[model samples]
Structure formats: C-alpha cells, structure tokens
Target: MSSSIPPSVKPGGHTPHDHDDAEHLKALGYASEFKRDMSAWANFSLGFTYLSPVVGVYTLFAYALATGGPPMIWSFLLVGLGQFTVALVFSEVVAQFPVAGGVYPWARRLWGRRYAWMTGWVYLVALLVTIASVVYGAGPYIASTLGFEANVNTTIMCALGLLALATVINLLGTKVLAVAAMVGFTAEIVGALAVGVWLLITHREHSLGVLFDSFGTGTGGGYLWVFAAAALIGVYQYYGFEACGDVAEEVPDPGRLIPKAMRRTIYIGGAAATFVCLALVLSVSDIPAVISGEDPDPVSTVLNDAFGATGAKVVLGIVLLSFLSCAMSLQAAASRLAYSYGRDGMIIGSALLRRFSPTRRVPPYALILAAVVPAAIVIGSKISTDAITKIISFAALGIYIGFQMVVVAALRARLKGWVPSGKYTLGRWGLPVNVAALIYGIVAIVNMAWPRTPDAPWYDNWIVALSGLVVIGAGLVYMIVHPLHDRSSGPYADAVPENRTKA
Candidate 1:
C-alpha cells in the first residue's frame, strides 16, 4: 500500500500524459467536490506568496546583520541548498499523491492512519502558529507605512485587521485567493529586483568582500554559532512552498502541475530572497549603528538613505503588499489543511469543519477556525510580548518538524522498495536524493532545537524543541482517547462510497 506507486493509483503507474484527476481521486476513495479552478501559474503563485521573500528577508535582515554581520547573508545560499533537497523529496511525494492536507494525507497513504493522524495534528497546529507569526511580523511594517505609532497595541490591532482580511479573502474561495497571490507575486519580484539593484548600484556601503568577514558578538565559538542561528532566516523563508501541494485538490491536473509548481517556488523564492538580503547588507549605511540599536529600523533607514522619506514610504507600501499576500496564502493553506482533516473525519466536529460554503465552494467554517487562532494569538501578544514571541518563534521549527516527518516517511518507503512514479521522477537518483534530504532535515531540526541562549531560562531557551515534543505528545493522547481506527483503517475506509473503485 505504501510506495512511490501506491496500489490506489492506476495499475500501469504514472502516465506521461494528463490522467483523469477525478478518476485518480476516485481510486483513492474521494470525490471531485472541490472546484479545480487553480491554473498552474496560480498554483505556483501560492507557494511563492507563502514563501514571501520580502516579508521574511526584510523582517529578519536586521536580526541576521546584528547576530552574524554581513556574512550572514550567505546563509541563505547554504540553507537554500539544504532546503532544496527537502523540496525535491516533497515534489516527488506530492506528485504521486496529489491530495489535499499535503503532508498529512501523503503520510497516511504512504505510512498509515496513525502516522497520518499525528502528522496532521502536529502540522495543523504548526500552520496555525505560522499564521500568527506572519501576521504579527507584518504589523510593524504596515503600521510604519501607514503613519501609525507602530506600538504593541497598534501592531496587534493591525495584525488582527490583516488576519481578518486574509480570512475573508479565503472565504471568497480559491479564485480570489489565486488572483491575490499573483498580484503579490508580481509585487514581490519587482520589489526585490528594484530595491536590490538600486541599493547595489547607487548606495553600496560595503564591498562584496564584506560578506566573507566574521563579524559576530557572542560568548561562544564566535561567528560559527552566530551563523548557525542566522540560518533560521533561510529555514523560515524557504518553506510554505508546500502550500501548493497542500491545496492540490483545488488545482487542475495536479499530478502534472503541482510538482512543477513546488520546484519553481523554491527557485524563484530563493533567488528573490538572496538578492534582497544581499542588497540590504550592501546598502547598510551604518552597520555598527544598526547593531548597536541606534538605527532601530534598519530596513526603513536603509531605504530612506538610498531614496529619501517619500521613496521609503512607497517601497514600504510594496512591502505591505507582500505581507497581505503572505497572510492570504498562509490562511488559504491552513484552511485547506483543516478541510482535509475534517473531510477524513480526522478532527472534532467533522461535520462542520468539512462543510463547503454553498456559494463560494470553499470551507467557510474551516477558514473561520484558521482565522480565529491567529487572532487570539494577536490578542495575547497585546498582553505579553514575551509569551507571543515564544509561541511565534515555534513557527519555523514546527514547520520543519512537519516537513521532516514526511521526508523520513518517504525514506522509509523508498528503503522498502518504493520507486517514485508520476510525471516527475528521480529514477535511479531517487535513493541518494532522498538520503540527502533526510540528512538535511535531521540536521536542520537539531539546529533549530538547539538552545541558542544558554543564559535564558530553560523554557525560553528550549521552547522550540519542547513545543514540538508537547504538540506531538498531545496528539498521541488525543488519538488514544478518540481512536480513529474505525474511520481510517484499510485502503477504502475514509473514501466516499460513490467514489470507491469497483472491484
């Protein structure tokens, strides 16, 4: 049942041509209920917007510079390569499975319901936290661009407001979301190239050699530890490309298209991020001032220095566009995850969570639930900055954990004689590629879980690792208490009876 070519797929294996997606869904025990309106470009746009380089690079640029100096920019190349291996593994799995819920469904089909349940549980909560983190990150940028005070209260309000807007767009259905994603994608690409070129040409404060310098201030093995910490910027930015696969059910010719979209997501997102980060570093008029907290708003300060206050506001406005697109993509992916879990009766109140909006053809309740958690987190941010930061910091770690589970499962299946099929196949290269992916994933997880601040309290220092363990443990308890064996067992148990293959 578990292999690159699952028995649920057509007997002959992957066809070079577009096979009947509906028939494939039927073979897997599902119906063509979703509106498969997403084009291949729109699909790619989701991943690109989710991995919004502008949002991630800009938000983390100052932190990276302060922690590891100009050399930190190179971590994008390092981490991007590592993450690309992970993306390769994901692209193969998604091509074969091409179902909703992404990693969760793929895990169930490749492993089993138990593994899938835990994967779904952990991944779902992780995605919720991701939404909170992204929205909160957007708040300050949006506030500054709009002339707000940019205080905690204002940031929280702005985050909540943005969250609501994203939720509403998701409720309108994938078409609206897709259009918004395309717009966001265009803005991000233009913004990255324009700003990077402008900074590099007109305002180059540092030479290219500066990127190789070891400039970090910490009481440890020096720049090595600092570089490792800064690598998380790449980790956080490169993910969410799987968002394309998460909503595969809504995309046309998913078997042929989703895999391509996933790869393109990495290529485009990575290049854009690398360019912008390099530009930001080169444009820093005063690196020491930024590190010392004198120039608190590094991104804005750099922009203003390069192109005055008016120009800075215009560029910040583009940044806000990227944030809006990011939130939309995050919520859209999250809702699909919720819907997929609900569709399989994998969560509480399966009836409501799985229901599609009569007119919109989207999961309204699921979208609502997705919006609610992040909003609550935003409210909590108002009460305690430290608490909110701890929770949000888990975003990258949580996502990487979910990703590694899929990679590990893929590796296990490959070792058991799984050969990847579908339009995109690694063929003889599959084994080594998969092995490399597993290694990178394991290393990345450990790196993320490693205690960065030894002097901080245990909870503060080990929150990322602990949050992952606690969530997985809680999932185990939930499964034991609720028990999903009856609904999830066997090849056809969770499939719609009408869509079941006639033996």
Candidate 2:
C-alpha cells in the first residue's frame, strides 16, 4: 500500500495513486477535496494521539482509584478486549466504505440517510464535547506546570488557550495536523514508558497481588457496579481509534490501510494505557487514603513521590501535549464529519460547511464550527465549576452510542445480505464479530450511562444517560420537523443499493 503512493510527490500534488483514490471517491458518488498526504504512520498517529493513554490515565486515575480501588485496573483489560471487537467490526465496515466521517459514512452506506443524519449529528456533538473535555482536563496540569493556582477562572482560560492552539494546528492543513499528531504520539509514548519503567523498578509500593484486592470499595451491587463506574477510564481511552477512518480520503488505499491503522491504534494504545495504569496503581503510596477519598489526585501524588517536583513538572508538560494533540485530532474528526454531512446535503449549512480551502485542502468552515462550539462549551463552564464535568459525562456515552449505531447498521446490512467487498474482510468470522461488537457496545453503553452517583443530585446522577437522550432527542425532533428528502446525489441517498455485495 505504501508503494502505491510515491514519497517524492509534493504536498497537495497529484500522482497516479491520487488518481486511483479519486476514482474510488467518484465511484462512491463524491469528488475528492482532501490532499492524500497522510501516510499509514500519520493515520495511525492521529488515532493513537486521540486515544492518548497519558491523557486518559492521568485525568481519570484518581477517580478510578477512589471509586473502585486497585482492582479497577482490570477494567483496562476488559474494556480493551471489548472495544477491540468494536474496532474489528469498524475495520470491516471502513474497508468496505473507506469514506470520510467514520461512523456517519459507515452508517449511511449500511443503512439510510435519516439514520446517517442522526449518527453523524450525535457523533459530531460528541467530538466537540470531547475536545472541550480534553482541553478542560488539561487546564489544571497546565496551571500547575506553570506555577499558577489552579482555579475555575485559570482552568477556563487555559482550556481556551489550548483549544485555540489546537484549532490553529488543525487549520494549517493535513500535513501539519499529521505532524502534530505524530509528535504527540512520540512524546506521550516515550514519557509513559519512561515513567512506567522508573516506577516499576524503583517506586514499586505494592505487589502484583494487590491488583485483585479492591480494598472494600463497592456498596449496592457489590464490586461489579463500582467496577462498571470505574470502567470509564478504559472506555474513554479506546474510541478515538476510529478517527483514522474519519479522514479516509486523506490516506491512499484507505480500504486496506485504514483498517490496519484502526487495529494498530487499538492494540498499541490499549497496551500503553494498561502499562501506565498498572504502574500508577502499584506506585500509589497510600492506596487506603486514595480509596477513602483523602488522596484526591493519586496520579499527582504518585508522580510527585516518584519523580519529585521538577521531574513531575516535566512529565506534566508531556501530558499537556497529549491533551492538546487529543483535542486537535478530535477537532479534525469533527470537522470531517461536518464536511461529510455538508457534502451529502444532510445538514443545514451544507454549502458553507462543505467549502474546502484550495490551498490547505481542508474544510475551513467546518474547522471553525468544530473550534467555535467547543470554545463555547468551555466558556459555558464558568456557569458552574462542574459544568465541564457534566458536559464531559456525555462525551464517552455519546461516542459509544454513535459507535453502536454503526455496529447495529452493519449487522442489519449483513442480515439483509450485504457482503463486504474490500481489501480487508472478516469473511467467515464477520457474523460472530459483528454480533459480538453489537453486544459489547450495548453492554458498555448501559454501564457507562448508568446512574451510579447516588449521593449527588438526581440530575447530576443521571447526567450521562440524560445528556445522551437529549442529543438523540434533539436530532429526532429536528428530523421530524424537517423531514429528510433524498436531496443528496451521493450513491446511497436514502436508498440501499440493490446489489448488497458491491461497494
């Protein structure tokens, strides 16, 4: 696949492989706008950076430890395997479609326009919220690293600054975005591995056996419920792998390479997350205090102990990069989804959103939409200290919902006799993998959205599930108000293809 496109071609330059990619897009009823500059590594880097292990583990370490104790680390393995199944299912679908806007395109090609609209709307909102959540999460670390007091005002400002930086990088073009992602991936992996190894060799405070010891943390439904709540760490770390397919047109031979990138993102990102979590878990100096809520930020507590103040600040810098990279990749994905919707005439501002920058080969209007909404979300955080958290509570669940929509659509297509015709196909294992993906996605969604916070206000407790319902409900109401017509000239414009086996 690498040999298909020559490395000598200049940025935005055309070649034989470019013509091939264009032909593929034309066959799918769309003209190519993105420059095919992202290589397999760049594509994988986008997904890996979005699924940043350092960002995920550091942000949620204290919460997971406090909620479920040491045993919560197991959720990484469980959720990793579960999400990998979803990745496999996605791999198959992306191989067949290889279209922009990952879940939305897959869902549209597999189902119909209304279904695609809802899926894209939900996923686009989720990506925007996730960008806000990531940069917001980065604020405290930024504040602490810069020797400033971490407060609501400071955090909000820091979040806005990071969001602006990420947006600028994204606006630069595909090459810049890929470079930023690759740099982020490199820094995060090196930092995580260095920290993990150092902690294991010199800062080991607990034995491997401690992983099984929950330290008596669960209440109503035994440890299982608490474990489910704690599973947010792994759940949040996994889904960004699909971002690779979000820019399917930006990579040559995406049907083959995108699936490989998705699988690699899952395998490599999962391993990095588990290693980081395991090291952090074993290095916690006061597990009992963490479980009892006395040590609120165990990641900081462990890092400060292991590396001291100066060294910890350096690690924090790396974490800040991971957060920024994650936000940038997410914004890129969101913009692509917006662009895809616009291209298909599925959204209100189709013309503006679909307008591509001739020089940059990017959807400038869509990128602005991605950045503006998330910035507004960050600004809205000033209304309440927990506003960002409430918004973020919806991010993981929203993503899971979007993912399952695609999974369900794929299964429905399969039952309707659609066979995947692509370079990569599951063949005999397709049915079982699709079924497993659906089952796992449903269970994970239920687990993620379950009202687990009993002592909090009713609304706070149900925020995750409620937020998801609100988004989906809003989309449903809009579709009903403006009942969708087959305005799109795209291949599958509100109509499933008669030949299910053809791509």
What is the clash count for each candidate, in the order shown?
0, 0
Clashes of 2: 0
Clashing pairs in 1: none
In candidate 1, what are the lDDT values of residues 1-503, reduced to their tens digit? Answer: 66576554445644332258877777777874677768889999999989999999988888888877788877788888888888888888888777887888887766667777787788888889888988888898789878899899999999998898888888888788888888889988998899899999999988988888655455477667888887777877788688999888888789778888988988889999999999988888888787777877798888988989989888988888888898899888888888888888876877888898878889888899899998998899878998988887678777887888888888877766666676677888887888898888888888889997889999888999888888888888888888864474335212222323332
Query: All predictions: root-mean-square deviation over Cα?
Result: 6.7, 3.0
In model 2, residue pairs whose N, Cα or C atoms come closer than 3 Å (at least 3 residues apart or on different chains), thus clashing, are none
lDDT of 2: 0.88
- Residue-wise lDDT of candidate 2 within 213-301, one digit each (tens)? 98888865698888888888887778788999999999988988999999999889999999999999999988999888888888888
Per-model TM against the reference: 0.92, 0.95
